[model samples]
Target chain A: MNNHENTAIEFNQVSRHFGEVKAVDSVDLTIQDGEFFTLLGPSGSGKTTCLRMIAGFDHPTSGQIKLHGRDVTNLPAYDREVNTVFQDYALFPHMSVGENIGYGLMIRKVPKSERNRQVRAMLELVQLPGLEHRKPSQLSGGQRQRVALARALINKPKVLLLDEPLGALDLKLRQQMQVELKSIQHEVGITFIFVTHDQEEALTMSDRIAVFDMGRIVQTGTPSELYERPRTSFVASFVGTSNILSGETAQKITGSAQNISVRPEKIRLVAPETETADSFCAADGQVTAVVYAGMITRYTVALAHGQTMIVAEQNLDDVSKSVATSRGKQVRLIWPCSANNVLQDPE
Target chain B: MHYKNNHRPKTPKGLLLSAIGVLLFLHLPFAIVMLYAFTTDETTFTFPPPGLTTKWFGVAMGRPDLWAALGLSLKVASIATVFALLLGTLAAAAVSRSKFFGRESISFLLVLPIALPGIVTGIALRSMMGLVNIPFSFWTIVIGHATFCVVVVYNNAIARFRRMGDSQIAASMDLGADGFQTFRYIVLPNLLTALVAGGMLAFALSFDEVIVTTFTAGQQSTLPIWIFSQLTRPRDRPVTNVVAFLVVTITAVPILLAHHLSQRDNL
Candidate 1:
């Protein structure tokens, strides 16, 4: 671990319960001073519950949450030094954008002249300087999102929490905002705790991601670690698409080979007639289906042991000329022994 | 099953007869009173052979008793409406949004006075005030009207609060605002329209209320009570008609305005 003393936020075994249901169970995490950390999971997976606890909207049933080494476990939301951007952008419909952005400073009892200056600067930062007079209903979805960010950032809190902030945008706009959010975080240099159910969003925007299952975190790692070295089957299936195969672990056939896992893109297909006998980790299978995407082709192959494996090949050149016709025919799959990742089965 | 497949009559003749029956059931008494108000004869109900005159309108306007009653009714309604708006909104916010023991029971009891019969509430309040040894005055009448009027405001405020998601309040609190600041900046603006609509409705209901007002109000004559007393004495019949017409205009205008404001907010 890096010996950085600048820890912005930490949760020490925090748990929350509603009636008999434990919504969040024993979560422990540390967010660095200027890092963008994401809590990624599906619905009812405790990701939002964790984010709310950090924001002080929900108090933990047990354990504690600390901000800059101060215990804020039972602080009211208004007493905490954090701000949030909601999923629907939650802009005040009655106020103009200028008023909405300046609301936090006004509540802090800052002088009007200084508040106006900071509001203008934050508006310019979001690229919405001239549109301050418009109401939230008058703006497009993306513009409203930027105003929400500006409103939360104007307070200059110790940390910022965002709850599914881009869940309402279209796919194209969501991708564009992903870049904008990351760049804005870098520019502001404040710790950000973001919650999102979209796996791709977490992978794209976060410095590190904590993957949550039902009420507990399954894994937490950097993007590359999560993709290439998943320690559990849940992480492998959740981080990205993977075709799972179940079989008894055999003796190592190659150096350092235990149980084998091959990524879909790494697997190669060869025609049955021209197949060599020395192909590495070769498996014979019948082609069940072929899906033709524009940049790649995916084949669903059924092995002799009734396990289906998916293989994807990029179309570097004309795919028709590179391989013989094998849409319905049996084929052989091969991959390097080093490409397989061994992960423990899920409980 | 046979009832489900029976041929229902779709002719305009059947619909027209039902519509006329409903109209007659609702308006027959008002039509009779209006016809009698214009008659020149000083005797019991007679349909024909009576000349019409605008002289009674002038005489009704000249009476001091009617004007006094009208003034007292306006004061009571205004005071009751303001008190109901303040207390009702606070009660709604506390009961609807907070979690504590007996919260459901408190909400249920708050609406009980309005749900029960008006006479039952009036009698109950009369005995309660007597036990406390508080004499009936203008304040008593205002309190009586406000007890029921509060239900209207509380109901409207609670519904609006529910429709507005809790995220707006959370966002405001997160943005360095204290609890009161969040209430002022975020919660109050959203609640303004609902309160105005509910206030106007409460005012209208209090203005026309006579059943409970009759028991709680010992000597003060509100417009409805004044009209009721005038119905017993024949010399004041024409003035009662004039007062009734004016009451309809006063109550209808605020209700219509409140309806328009609520519809605008919905859009």
Candidate 2:
């Protein structure tokens, strides 16, 4: 009942059940206009199901789905003013790239000349110009991904849903596409609801993200907020690597009984003689394992009170040699008390 | 030197010989049939087909009854193939694209006509026609052939539908296409090659079918039935061989073409 002018999509306690299984449990969500929002979760966490419902490919078992304040719970996908870039690309195999990109306009009864012009423009916008004559099967994986993007974008939908469209690309191509996708969203100024299981991809591109677990949104926040102040243990562990300190171990460090989470990168390695400052929390431990990644090294420290914490340190200057050789050595791990994000127990 | 050795031909001699033996066993009978179509001697079995004159081919071509039967067989196969393609594709789409009660059982029933003995299907169709007082004619023959042809197309169409997946259809809809437009643009194009291959296979199946056609066609003769009757005559033996060769060619072309189309899809 709030003003819906700026709300691109609103799910009013939506739930989708497949007979006995609750694929998407009852959830309330709102996506603002022109925001690059992401639904992030592991497989079967209902991220894709949420995107499908928004696209009208799926219907909610209960509750209402509103698009720009209009009820579209029973509207078919074609009637909705939304388009999707599917994970498999789903390019029409028989059509050339030009035809695939122009299919939407053609369906809408656009003239052939105008449709072709728009297809060309879209192809260029996706950075895949002059390859329109080739069929989808003739293109490489990355090219096909671009073609799918162009095809959906040509329709000029009010909102665009991307369901792991970059999942099929190689590492280098995927990273490149991430930056390109963010720029495209900015250029179009269209509301984007992207679904991805890769939390890093969600963090790198999305303006805001909803972390889902077990058919429910565990948390929704900006990337920095979710990374810095994860409200639940699932959110703390899923969004990024966190050293979840709780129970007696948390009491010993923070003098509090509540569960807290500290990120691996937030903890610093210091000399054993270093004293804990009033504004900082410190734990005495022995370095048990060292993992040397290219840009960073992670150390597993077994605290004296019997819990283990992982500390990630950048391989900068002499820190790399020292941390790589720190196994079996006594160390003091300290971080600002502000870094200890208190968590509510996951239900 | 090492590279050349690694690249050396590695086909085993015994395996090659056995493969050649199997190929000859399967094809040598057809080669003899071809040779006898040009045999000069009639009503006699002779080694090497004494004096291959090509006279039987001319005689076989001149028969008005043979032409009538060939024309009828082609008409029946064409109509049956069309029926099979339509019904089979619809059945395939329903089974593959929807979730409903008894979907699996429906799929199992679709292929039952091809699985059961042809004589059993023939008898069943004949009895049903009798019970309904429906006259046996060209239409009955087409219907009988379609019963099994539908299975051929369904098998091909269903396999392709499953492999092609439903994502394309969903993509089509998400791109602002209604049900008809989605099928016309997305589903139909993706399904074209499969349907063509299936239709070709169905045509071949209906062309040479004998048992079912016999029960369905009352007072009518298709090419296979004509060949069956010609086999009883001793004087027209070489002529029958010529007609059989023509039938073999006609059926083999579509079957081979369908096989080639399907094989290309794998690449």
Candidate 3:
């Protein structure tokens, strides 16, 4: 056990089951202090369950959880020094913005004047200044989310758990909140455990991320580390899009009969007869389909061995080497051999 | 509240006539009762009275028996409403938040008192009181009224609990509040409006309740029991009409208030 004050939260083989369904299987992990860590997974991957157990809203079916190096598995949420920003921004509809932000302090029986001052300060931090008198129902979705953040942050908990806090916002607002939330986490210097299924969000703001699947933690690493060197097929395919190669094609590409992953962005478009470079692996294929996505174009290349790979390239201003107009053209797919990540053998 | 653009106000002529006809059919008798309370003649029905006077209202107000019955009814209804609010909210919170064995059956049983024929509930309560050798009195009337009032509050509160969603409670807990604190700070506020709506409806129903009260009250004289007995007496007819008007107003106020309170939440 690496129990220490620097570790904000640690799970020791914690598992939770609801009768027939195993919501979260035995999992071990540690979140360090003042680090922005994210749990990334699709729905039903048990990431939210893990966050709930940490917040003390749930108890593990077996094993233990420690908060700030103290065993809090049996502790209630009120006793735990952790707060959460919910997905729907669960602000009290009846209370004004200031009252909602000041709720935690009010519950703690803080002085009225001090609570108001702290609420105002927290509101300013979230950039929703001087709107405390307005009801949550009257505010827009983005403003309500900011109030939720302020309310949770005012408690000044050791760790803040954000469960898809930006899920309710529109695309533009979500991107904007992403940057603001990251900066606020840095400013507050609280250990943050953010949960999201959006891989881009995880990659953008997280100092490190844990990928989950089927009630287990598949991999844990920095965003680039997981993106560039996923140790398993699920992590490789889930973190960012990857062209998975196995069987004979895997042997031909890397001289080993092992599953490997090559990212679509890593493959470059080259001439049909280009000679393979010492540092890069090369293969010949026919461009079967092209998909235009405004700034970039993706080509589905069907190799000689009946395997298909998706290759994406920037749609530069020069129109000559464009994949959009290169349909049915023979091409060579090449990427640095070092870019290919060998995944563990499938069980 | 901003539904002006969505209004489809052009009702068909046939539907409009039918709606008006239905409203009049339901309310015309109550209007007649109000009209009779002001009739000058004591024992006769007239198309237009020789003179309309407020003398019956004065007579009804002066009677000591009438005051006693009104006081008893108000006391019973208030006590019944209090018990209903407590037990109904507890039952709703349990059924809505936790999925345990027999949850559906418990919910169905909670609503059974109101759904079944009042005579059936009266007979059931009366027989149980008899088997236990419990004397029928003011307390029995309150208990009888509470049986159905609990259903009213439970129905309203349970629906609100479901619509309020589960995340609000989770959010409260995650915000450093325990179960009691979560209820006080989060759950209670959301349900306060709903509880008010339910409590008012329960009060209105208990105030006007007649059948169950008759079986439960052995010697106690409630307002409805007095009204029932007075209907058989020929001399106090106009006074009975005046008291009926007062009862109708007392019951109508809470129903309308509950409607207004619950509707405001939709906005």
Candidate 4:
């Protein structure tokens, strides 16, 4: 684990209130140097607000923010060592692609020749070379996103903030840019604080993910850690699909007064006559619904005495007609004890 | 491409006649003025003037009063347009970007100068000048013109600001640009064409402004004021017609140019 001095950004009890709305509640977090950290949540969940404070677009109403171990809570955006790739790209319409990319250098009084060289180099870094004089209006959506990234990365700031930078692209383009953006972060070695609401995007590229909810960070961990061992029901259901167990059914399974979650993939279906392992928890249920997704079949099973759970099975072999019609049939649902993860009831 | 007879909507004859009737009603007098500028009969409005000539053009150009009034009008219009552009853009930036107490009223006050009767505005300005004990001079004329001129630019600027949401400026700040630098590089470039359109319209409006200029211009003659004085003189009727023709062209050209520019921006 990295020490405290290696932290690139630290939010210390930061909060921003707008009259009656707490746009960002007290958020305390430390982003490691050269890490790809994501702030993931739904819209109006304060993910973007936290990113704005780090970028110095919004000052916290109370508490402090440190950049590279220095207090910069009140510093203006220009003085901060960070750049952002905006969601809409926001390229200057009046300037050519080259001028837009080199704008930061121009603002800092860099000479024209050096600025052009850096712009060309940055363009190449984003895999867009030699198409400098074209206007932003003429470019396609994906091309404009690349230009936006190149423009922010040209400055080589300590951190690159991305606010849903791939949102404007279609799904195929978004997937392609996700890979490209991850590789770019690796090459630049800059701490990147990305804000996105898409769970798939957060899972794919982030080294660490912070799930925000209603102006607060609910959980922060590596992608798999968040998925497998969520501390709360919100994190469990939000990070991935989980079958939540509550009421007396949860007490029967865990032998404690607690709620629990089990991943759909971890639950298995077996005939009642089959012998079970001692380490596994077993339940008798009838399949209520069957969902046939391409590579998997999902079963919505209702356990005896009323709790419903979802179980997913990979199509390891062809599902015969008998297996497909098991929607109304009785079955034994079994999963290893390790798969039963206890979750705290949400506050 | 020619429209197919089957696809075209048939126009009623009454509507067609009314369209031309409205066109003639609006522009016929201006056409008559242009025709009179070329007439040989200087003192009378005879049918077709018996002959067409270009002598009044030279006569109007030779007068010193024409030169002084033309120069003063140009100067006043320019100064007023500049003043309007600066204040109007700032007010627009504030109004469009921020939500504050009485924001709607601020917008209302900015536009009220042009929306109210021009004579009422003129009276208010004249009385304000009297209360402040500020002597009426060239600056007073400029202030009066700007009271209405600012609204022209303000309307254009605020519409533009609303279209360009807050994300652009956020991106600029994120790219490490200070406020002034962001305005110079991003905001100003995007705003240039709109400002040009609004500025030209303001200039056109200020150049021929009469009521406000009457209250503000103390013993000074703008081109419109000079034209008002020329109306009663029987001998200089042809020269008056020539100057009126020039005024119409001067004002109409900018408005046309403004329209063309703003239309191109939309595309």
Best-matching candidate per TM-score: 3
Per-residue alpha-carbon lDDT of model 2 for B1-267, expressed as tens digits? 455877987889999999999999999999988888888878976997778787787888789999999999999999999999999999998999889999999999999999899999999999999999999888999999999999988999999899888789899899888999988887887788888999999999899999999899999899999999988888869998898789889988888988898888877
Candidate 1's DockQ is 0.65
Q: Each candidate's DockQ score against the native complex?
A: 0.65, 0.86, 0.71, 0.71
Candidate 3: segments with Cα more than 4 A from true spot: A1-5, A318-325, B1-17
lDDT of 1 by residue, A1-347 (tens): 23336888888898999888989999888888898999999899999999888898889999888888788999988888899999888899989998889988888888989988998999899888888789898999999999999999998888989999998999999999999998899899999999998888888899999999888988889987887777777777888777555553223223342444567887888876455445466667898888778688888898766777899999888877434465677988777655667777554
TM-score of each: 0.85, 0.94, 0.94, 0.91
Kindly list the per-residue Cα lDDT of model 2 for residues A1-347, writing each as its tens digit: 57799999998999999989898999889999999999999999999899999999899999899999999988999999999999999888878999999999999999999998898899899898899899888999999998999999989999999999988899999999999998999999999999999999999998999999989998999999999999999999999899998889999989997999999998999999797779999999999999988788899999998999999988777566675578899999999999999999754
Clashing pairs in 4: none
Clashing pairs in 1: none
True contacts kept of each: 0.90, 0.97, 0.80, 0.88
Query: Per-residue lDDT for B222-263 in model 3, tens only?
Result: 998999999888885899999989999999988898999999
TM-score of chain A, model number 3: 0.97
lDDT agreement of model 1 with the native: 0.84
Q: Give the per-residue Cα lDDT of candidate 2 at B80.
A: 98
lDDT measured at residue A234 in model 4 versus the true structure, 0 to 100: 85
Clashes of each: 0, 0, 1, 0
What's every prediction's RMSD, in angstroms? 5.7, 2.7, 2.3, 3.1
lDDT of 3 at B103: 95
